[model samples]
Target: MGSAWTQSFREELSVGKVKFSLSQPELLLQPQWSISPLAWLLYRLFMLLYTFIWCLYSALLFSSPKWLLFLSHIVYCSMAMYYLLALCNLVWAAIQVRNFYRNAAANQNEGSRVRGGSVGPFPLPPLLSAALRLQWCLHNLVSSFSVTVTLLYWMLVYPIEKHPLSTFNINMHVGNSVQALLDLVLSSTPIHLAHYVHLFLAACLYILFLLLYWLSGGTSLSRKPYIYKVLDFGRWPLVAAFSVIGFICIGLPLGHFLLLVPLKV
Candidate 1:
């Protein structure tokens, strides 16, 4: 039993293997079940627009001077980028479809001249292929990271920070997770077990940024040494370290697993 379970775990990780792909762009752009691709496209467009408007509003509300300090803003930007890339992928898919039909018609004409000759479907352009892979990675990263940020914000940051519940606050914290959950459920994007590494790396990068910011005596807009009191590594290194570990090691994987449940169902 132990050996069998170990093998199953190994297969789940698919270690040393390239788990991502640029082929079958439909898998990234289309819906999972019978929902129309047009519907999915429109939904993605709506999300893109919604996130953009709020992001612009946020920029104006907070102003440009303090935009870089907050992790919430970073995650919001990531969310916006994810949707934007998704829209681009949909456009690419549409172009690929049109090209496929055009190629087929041309091949049919050529086949009459040279009987039994045919051509395969159109291949993705090199640039679009790379963009699809980026979209896939962002899909995994944003899905897990948005949920983690939401959980940490409401559970940890809200109480002590004592920030009043406002529209922007709710939108950034709660609405981001809602969007992620909807995307996970509605989209056909596949999530791999090892993809959680993206979230882990992002967490590590933020931790490094925190250390550097502290070392350089950087401060939040409020002029606090740390970005968030929970992540105040300078004052409470152990707490911050454990928080990062818990989110990256525990929260992120669990969130990814939960997101997988919808796909599996």
Candidate 2:
């Protein structure tokens, strides 16, 4: 069984005959379970509202001095953007549905047969297509980033911290993961095993940010030279490098695999 499962996972990672599509807008709009699209839309809207409001609260809490240092804030911002894109995808879908029905009605009035399985003149509009692509990319990004941020924070940063965590900190770390998991379970969004590349790329980008910050003499809110103690490149360069490499190579793929299990259900 282990061998077979490993083989199956390997097949997913195969680059041969790989294909991706954004032509089916329904797959983007509809839920995996038998639920109304409106329900999904409403859920997305609520998430957007929550994340947006909390982002504002976090801004106030940090008060701009330390806002840019934390990875939590960056991931939270990405989550907000993901939810916003999701909401826009739904609204665009609704518009297409309405137009489709209106066109059908007009055709019926003219005594012409309406074509079935057509939504707003077939091939989706260019703008909607672009939006769906962006939404898909962000979905993959947030899934990995949220889980990584939560695990890293709780395991590495929280344990050695001298101060107790605030509600905002807890929400940013724990709640973000919950939101991402709920999105995975509740929606029809597809997760491709090979898409772990997105996570790896994001990890690399963050490492670059750390290097730049170090070079620029940026500090944490506590006025420490590094953002997080574990990631303090200047103080413990080897350890920090290994931590990033491990996350990019192991942590990201593991998180993506966990997400895939839910989708397979």
Candidate 3:
């Protein structure tokens, strides 16, 4: 019976014929405080605007004429992409909430709860719903990345005390890291182990990009093919292996901790 049900579900999903329904509005998954659809839409838009501004500011700081310069480094690319995905997810969520309410209003008998698989918010089609669920997961990983970057640069790579003359750099570093960490703390999204794949793939892609840049003869101000000294290709196999392991150690624990955050009822 389980196998038959699973097969039917898969077939329904393949044809986009599946519909999901939930009995209660409060049962919906949300990160942080739930607000009106308009408020949610505005919140996402505000974040999108901030992300755009930050990218421009970062570009100016680098003062590089080539657009590829930003793409070459994982920091800007990954972080920016994260914000973009968040913005998209917010839009989808807003739509879902709007649809939910509209359906509820139409069906005066249903109270505040969602019903039927017809066209309500709650149980979205499996694929799109799954994608929506990923938003917070990616957010957590990106937040982890932000924290990791700050710690790695400030504590392990170069302490602010050593670079006292570069106070502006310190401000940027602290601002970015603090904001990311705060966002994670404020969110109400639940973490899932399956979503760890997204984090892993993100890291792998960045490493691949760096290697490709090196192979293509990209160089920094110091004429090294790699942007960070820790990634210096000259050190080869050992450096590469250690860097990967080190990131996993930092990321996995951080992700697990986010999952462990106590949820407010």
Candidate 4:
């Protein structure tokens, strides 16, 4: 008992009271979120929060310096508003799909051994399977191409020299009717218009994912295995994420939102 007590205290792993405090944060570790749809939803939520906080932090950082803060807000507000609008719209769609599935499962599972397997196998004919796969492949390819081009513009082109607004493929067609109106009203600059347009295209892919998710009615058999399904949902987001990583690799010449105009000396 004496040696046990000595060894426990001597080891770095044991500190008794401090262990509880140290491990408190780990209690929030989310195993349920290991699955894809859940994970993607969490990720989307976090990114939305992250952008919001990042903008807020930037705003507060320059609070004492009014001119600089206003300048900072100009960039932050322009970018953040679009992000917030898109994020909320996507979240609402996801919730609609989720609730539709939940109510659906409740209806069809009166006394079955299974939960929601009544969705049964898809009636996809051989032709349709091939066609769906082809469509998926094309969707992924175009999505990848868009990611690549945008990253190239942000990293290589913008870093060295400013390009004309005509360079980027900026078409602003996002959201439902009401949200689209907000996007149209808010988006004025060519650069911001370009960003918002790409987001709109990305939103379409997400909507397609949501459509597939609910079309199959969000059941286990109605879905792919959880891992595959999550990967499927994350496909386009992954492209965008990695492309952003490439942009981060280039990073900024100095700090965040530093130079919009080319310096002349």
Candidate 5:
């Protein structure tokens, strides 16, 4: 019966694909919060605004050569991107809260008194409350720290060069008498190091995120399901994706100018 029920629920979720959890905490809050559609829509609206701003920043840099070298402009754009990500997460958090409210309403309608108006049934499981609080703290701290550091790094490292791509000495093996290829990484770079740090922190955030989702659902971490195990392993692909993009975002523009550029492969 649970299999049939889970299957039906999964099918409905798949049809929309836009809403609900593929894994943990997202589903946790929905059943618990009873979030209203209006509340959810409001959060989505924030995301829309957030995306528009990102596009605006990109266009500004691509079109206006004047802003490219200005440290202040670069800082502003970086900060804007950070804020956008933060806004998205804030919306996610709201969705979770709403789900809590929805679930509370459901539980109350059944006369269970489970969570009066989203407080989560009295005497609320003390451990559950503690766990949820911990999860929230971890997620927010990671989010804020990552965004803050990223903005600071870009601001401090804005390039002075007009067209930075001219400097890298390129080597190619078209006629291969020798098969060896030279892979060079620049030795002195704060920007490259800062991005590495960001990658590490982001990984921490993803793991913390999964833990939080489990806590929100009142599920014990000890009993992590096969699905979550799959999510945990997903970190590798995420890291790979981020690595390429990070190099492009941080290293590519600078690498073009730097005397000694690193080979990402």
Candidate 6:
């Protein structure tokens, strides 16, 4: 045991001790949102509405057996899948927003209110939240690809092709491009070139699907065994060359531009 020695001190003395604690600001760790809550909510509603309208239009066209024949085209197939993805993303975003609002309300004990400018609540574990954000990024990237493909087809392919205009008219070509562009603009994810890999993969899968469909004896309305005359497998060399050029030059660049344009704002 040590002896307690009394010493004379001139400094201020207090009966109780003072404690100091340090805390990290939540903003430092929270994910940065690219858009406001109100904007995102309105965009979600618009996507849901646009998806419903497209589905109804497709259903009406499918009612006719003649119109059903046009479904073999890659344009219709890709646009259909794009809208479906948009609907899915919309649902996920809605759920996230709801949870954000609820959490903000419950956490009001800390004097933080759920407002349009807030970071919004994210209750998901770190890994799960990251995965969700990645999915959202890929989803928007695909939306950009859909728009690029649709416009390229319309301006370049459809104009030169001799396919029946009646069949094409029933497929809602303009609407598909417009809705996809809207989705791309309304997306809150920051655009990154690395995400372009998802677009490439999607294109590759679509090309494979077209090849399989052709192998199964699918024929377009023009009586051509190929959906796009340029993609006719009979000329494998031309098809390969065009695919390479399209992916590298047209598809990648177009998608990159489409995604970056809105971000420039």
What's the TM-score of every candidate structure?
A: 0.89, 0.89, 0.64, 0.27, 0.25, 0.58
What clash pairs does model 3 have? 31-188, 32-188
Please give the distance, in angstroms, between residue 25's alpha carbon in candidate 3 and its true position after superposition.
Answer: 11
What RMSD does model 4 have? 22.7
Report backbone clashes per prediction.
0, 0, 2, 0, 16, 0
Q: Once superposed on the true structure, which residue ranges of model 2 sit more than 4 Å away at CA?
A: 1-7, 16-20, 111-121
Question: Ten-residue segment with the worst summed lDDT in candidate 1?
Answer: 112-121
| Preferred candidate (TM-score higher): 1 or 6 | 1
lDDT for each residue of candidate 6 in 1-265, tens digit (9 for 90 to 100): 1222112111112221111101211221222457665565565556556555655566575564334433223344444554455445445655766787776766774666544546533455454445444445445554566566666656656776844666335345555556556555544444444455556665666677667777888776556777666667766658655864675568666866666656643
lDDT string, candidate 5, 135-252, tens digits? 3333223233333333323332223212243211010111010111110111111122223333345445544554455446522224433112223323455644454345445543
**Can you give the lDDT of residue 50 in candidate 2?**
96
Native-referenced Cα lDDT, model 4: 0.36
Give the runs in model 6 whose Cα sits over 4 Å from its true position.
Answer: 1-43, 62-121, 125-131, 134-138, 162-172, 221-223, 235-240, 262-265
Tens-digit lDDT track for model 2 on 1-265?
7887788778778774133466466777778888876677788899999999999898887787578567778888888999999898889878886887787778877767555634344557888888887888888889878888887778777886744677887798899889999888887777788887667778788889888988899888878898878788888999888888877887777777778876644
Per-residue lDDT value at 162 in model 5 = 25
In model 2, which range of ten residues has the least summed lDDT? 114-123
